[model samples]
Target chain A: MSSVTTTPVPRPATVARPTGRTAPVLRQLLLLALAVVVVAPFAWMVTTSLKDYADVYRPPYLWPQEFHVGNYGRAWDAAPFAGYYVNSLIMTGGILVGHVMLDTLAAYAFARLRFPLRNTLFLVLVATMLVPQFVTVLPAYDLVIRLGWYDSYAALIVPRMADVFGIVVLRAFMASIPAELDDAARLDGAGPWRSLWSVTLPLCRPALATVGMFSFLYAWNDFLWPLLVTSDDTHRTIQLGLSTFSSKYGTYPELLMAGTVTAAVPALVIFLFLQRAFIRGVASTGLK
Target chain B: MLAPTLVVIGVFVVYPIVGTGYLSLTSWDGFSEIKKWVGLGNYTRLFRDPAFLNSLWVTVLYGAGVCVAGVVSGLGIAVLLNGAFRGRGVYRAVFFLPVVTSSIAAATVWRYVFGDTGVLDAVLRFLHLPAPNWLGDPSLALVSLVLLTAWKSLGLNVVLYLTALQTLPADVYEAAAVDGASRWQQLRRITVPLLAPMTFFVVIEGLITSFQSFDLVYALTGGGPLGGTETLGFLTYREAFRLSHFGYGAAVAYTAFALVLGVTLIQWRLGGRERWSS
Candidate 1:
């Protein structure tokens, strides 16, 4: 009865009942196998990070014979990774902060405030999503240079704040909030800012979180722009810092794997905590 | 309210796009004062440039391979998860892990997995089976990168499909069950037809994302043993950054943009009501 209750479909009284329990069992088993395929690479990545060069070459076996705990340390010493991590943290924080603040305000205005050319502006924003980042990078690079921001954190964070994706996402979530709330807030003598802060902002948490999570991930993993802007080691991010292993120590698989593992952990941790936001971001954005 | 957004987009997104288009028709090395106008020269050179041509071919192959393989595998996994199950949440999370992992980091791990003395070869040797260099051969390298790309991107597809499946009303399945239709028959008749909209959306999104494929090549092959793995994304970077040919790079970027826009437009026109993901 419990199993029957949990089943997705209710069998109609007129239906001829077939053996359904075994079918679910088989499906579950198949899913488990597929899950293993999806997860094996990450498992290998971690296992190999602790692996010695010899054990790595002996790859039929995934578990290391002895944990070389020092690989992380060695990898850390091999490059200025500490500096890179700090820079990455700052860069990710700066970009996401701008994205969340600017996008939420814009989305609120679009959703509730009266303005001329609003619909046209929204359409232009939607169209911007279709343009690839490569097309914009060249001119943005020119702008950054003219502003004398090359090799600075602003180079990584500033232009990225103009996020059409975030604007659309925020607008979508804001539109779903009933206009009646804004009207009621206005009747209660709340200005647009007050209503946004008290009613709308509270409601927009999930959507804001979604945009924050994605743009943070985008800033964290960005490679090319960082490489283009920085001529020196001053403002290096984790992704750009990762190149030392390839350029200087290509022979050291252990170090490369360890550095990759180190570089990946923060993003993974963020994703784990923000998994729901990430899924909602992908799902609602797509379905819309 | 709109002043800030307009200013930012005008300065960054809108102006940048126009500038890029104009830059594609000129010659500039990114740092110099001189930008010589050369209309259609860059586009003509793109076709004649064997390296660029090879990359276009490679990108088309990679994009198609990843789309087909990723969608099929993702739908299969999603279907499996849709059945009554224990630990479904855990399974779903486990599957989605790769989509969050950095592309560069994922490619770096795959390099070892597919490299000469890497994981696959060792496993094959232990089992006394053949292990061809997965990333060595030009053709195989393209295939290998496609495999990695699909693996990295599959989680998004699965999650999307799962959401779509969940939103499907349960009564249809119940009705089918009452009629004694076989599970596969119900899937074919009801599920596939109903899922068409979701399928169309996923494919368009997938194709758009695939056109931006560059990080994998940068991390794994660097466009490879004899330009075998050079992709349009990589070519764009190489033209502007490596060679300092900003104008040419802008042109390569435009070509990619047009290619993506054309295919998307065609798919929009012809793919309406077609059996896309199937």
Candidate 2:
């Protein structure tokens, strides 16, 4: 069950294909054109961020005549961004840690444990995937409010800590792991928890990393729930901070662009580092 | 061991969903002391409400536009990037960058681009083309939102399709070519058929994500320009949080949920069988 090797397809014969040399040149040009389209908005974003207000409104300066490096400082000072950053970091970190620990434990139980009603419960957990988060916003909001967790990190971080998708992915990966590992641990007088901690978790690193990356990205970029839960500036995430920038400084396109760039940097960094896993995660969802 | 998961799911996911269904039938104004049962009243009102109907239409349109555009362009770009090429990795990285960027940030940048005096408008002016106010105009607001969503989501789709393309068995294509199949025929017969599962996956995921489009519209249009861009999700957000109409908002949300669920179920029933066969 652990390994199902797929037969590799034989590579095509190395018959020297005589294509017009211009074909490669043309393909290069076309690919570059595609890349330009893809990168233009981002380039525009960075360029606009460097532009002053006058340069911003002046026919979309392709390059800033006078690059205002101070725009980053101005954008920082434009809102309680420091507080928002700390709040976002803490919330994302808390949610990531909670998800990795809890979801892994749950996945282990679902995949390896022969508990009563396990399949039924796992089915129910998968069914939860069909219900979009929007359906529960009101009740969740009510829960937060009733628990007096509104405008707090508890509201922001706690409910999403146990994600169904994380459990599903982890369970899928865990199901491939041989039960002999757990059995050996049990034979060594290890408890279920000990077997899980010592034997199972170590082997589930790839799945765990995928789950962790996704959880981090989700928590980092989550907007509506945070916006709905936390109204106070002190508890606002970076998204809320950027939105505030938009509303307060609606006229300063350059500053807003700078703030947007600032807000995006962390996610960009994560994507750059864990790109392969991130791409795999995205493709695994079959959302291509 | 499974008890923790069962409890959490039951408490968080199942309970809230059931609670939402119950709330949708109540006259709870979100801050009220007395909760009166209003069986189906919220649903009935939702049908009659012009705002709800319009938002529903907007959501459908947005979903369709994004699905069609994102999937097609994603596949096209993926196919283009499939061949061994110089700097392919960089192009892949650039294409997938939007997936990594925060949606709000992407929307903000797009909002600037779509601004009346922004780069897009300037370009149009340079080309002597008509430049409509994208988010500011009622007619183009939803269209602009759809465009932004497609742009932002295209990267993920590209990566997914690219992965699918690269993983295709080369022998299948070689056999097709041996049978005097042209490139177009090979792509149509072999590639597309083999990619059916990936395509279905893209459609379902695209539908889900497109339906839940909040951040882009929220950041760029705020469902503005006479609520032209107001999706059901946005409407629910406005009603529940902004207007404090919790019961009605819950009903709207449930309505959207039901629609998404119904569509997903249909896709599953239709596509899942085909996937198994393939």
Please give the DockQ score of every candidate, comma-separated.
Answer: 0.51, 0.56
In the range B1-278, model 1's lDDT, one tens digit per residue, is: 56677787888889999999999999999989888999989999999988888988888887788778877887778888775445766777787788877877888888878989777777788799998988889988888888888888787888888878877899999999999999899888887778776677677766776677778888888888677788888888888988999999999999999998988788777653443332
Worst 10 residues of 2 chain A by lDDT: A14-23
Candidate 1 lDDT tens digits, A63-154: 78889989999999989899999999998998889888888888988889988888998889878888877888899899999999999988
Residues B1-278, candidate 2: write the lDDT tens digits. Answer: 55565666676678999999998998788888877899999999999999999999888888888889877888888888777555776777888888877888988888878888777888888899998887788769888888888888878889878878978999988888888999889878888888887788788878888778788889889898898999888898899888988889889999999899898878888765564343
Name the lDDT value of residue B179 in candidate 1.
96
Give the alpha carbon lDDT tens digit for every residue of A137-231 in model 2. 78888888899998999888888778888888899898899999889999999998999999999999998998888888888899989988998
Q: Return the lDDT, model 2, position A222.
A: 90
- Residue B226 CA error for candidate 1 (Å)? 2.0
Which pairs clash in model 1? none
